[model samples]
Structures are given as C-alpha cells and as structure tokens.
Target: MITLVRTNDIVLISLIEALLREARVPLFVADAHVSAVEGSIGAFPRRVMVPEDHAAQARRLLRDAGLGAELAPSPGGS
Candidate 1:
C-alpha cells in the first residue's frame, strides 16, 4: 500500500474517505485507533493508504478535489 494523506483533521479524513468511496477507490485508514487512544487531541495523525497500483489515481482524485496539499509527497519527489 502507498500512503496518500496523513492528517489530524477527522473531518477532512471523513471527507476524503467519502470521496474515495464514491469513486470506488479502496482505502485503509492507518492509526485511526491510535488517534482515538490519543484522545483525539489532533496528535497521532491518521494515514489514508491505497494499493500501490492505485496510488497515482488516488492522488489525482484527491488533487482534483482540491486536496492536493494534503497529499504525502511521492517517493520520487513529485
């Protein structure tokens, strides 16, 4: 899996999840429980990940949604 976005904003995360779901892009939220364990104090930012093969498309989906700034930098520095 490739990391797409890492953020402490739950609302933004929810929005991203909804958008991805609507687009039929499979995603996994890592550190979700960790954030809850941290008392949702905006620490332990959660991560949204998708299959490696879908990373580019997922990034594009997010970018087109005006969430490009939220994206994790590509390993190649894109």
Candidate 2:
C-alpha cells in the first residue's frame, strides 16, 4: 500500500478513483474509514494499493491523469 496522494478534498478522491478505474487501473482504497472519521479534516490521508506488478502501471495512469508523481518503486515488478 502507498499514499499516492493526500488531500482534505473529498471530490478529488472520487475524481481520481474514477479516472484511474476508467483507465483500467484497479486501485485498493485504504484509510477510507479514516477519511469518513476525519471528514476531510485538514486533508485526510488515504492509501491506495495495487499489486506489485500493477504498481508501475497504476503510477503512470495516475500521472497521466495529472494527479501526482509516483511515490515509490514497486518492490515487485516485471
């Protein structure tokens, strides 16, 4: 799991998720409960995870959407 992006902005999360999904990149939602708890308090941090193999693809897909840069190297990759 990695924190690809963080923001107290609720709309951004949904937008990013939808964009990623539309691009055929599956992402795991993390700290979702926290987001609800904080109610976007000063920007709640959310975690998004993908398999090691899909990590790079995920990053690229997100970047292409103008989300943010890749956070880390995938420990598992081709």
Candidate 3:
C-alpha cells in the first residue's frame, strides 16, 4: 500500500510533487483538502502519497527543498 505525507502548503506541495516526479518517484493522490490557513476556500491543504519505499527519499527531497528537517527516523516508523 502507498503512504501519505503532508506538505506544508499548496505551493510547497506542488513543488515537492513536481520535484519528486522529476526525480522519477511514483506518486498517488491520497487526499487534497483545502486548508483554512490560506483563507481562500480552495487555497491549500493538499496531501499526497508515494510508494512506501520512496517515503524516506521523499521526505529527504522535501528537506533538501528547505521544507522541513531531516533526521534518522525514530524506532517505530519510516
């Protein structure tokens, strides 16, 4: 099964998705809800999923894009 990860914002989400695509990471849409933070109704809050194997690499890619911090995963999950 695929795993879903949240992007901080719609623009960041799109950027990360595009970058992931360019990197050849397989993607799937899990959810794409609107975020109230953007306050435009359809402003943001989209989420996406990739194959489980690619999750780490996806987070690393986002970290590389300056979206979030990357560290070794904790004992339980990937």
Whole-model lDDT values for every prediction: 0.91, 0.65, 0.62
Best by lDDT: 1
Model 3 Cα shift for residue 76 (angstroms) = 3.4
Best by TM-score: 1
Residue-wise C-alpha lDDT for candidate 3, range 5-77, written one tens digit per residue: 5544566567767988999988865445335555665545455777778877776776787766422342246
TM-score of each model, in listed order:
0.93, 0.65, 0.60
For 1-78, candidate 2 gives per-residue lDDT tens digits of 555555555677777778768877667777778778877465567666665566667777777777654344445432
lDDT by residue for model 1 over 1-78, one digit each (tens)?
A: 988999988899999999999989999999999899989578699999998888888899999999999999986789
- For candidate 3, give the lDDT of residue 27: 80
- After superposition on all CA atoms, how large is the RMSD of candidate 2? 3.6
What is the clash count of model 1?
Answer: 0
RMSD to the hidden true structure, all candidates: 1.0, 3.6, 4.7
What residue pairs are clashing in model 2?
A: 8-43
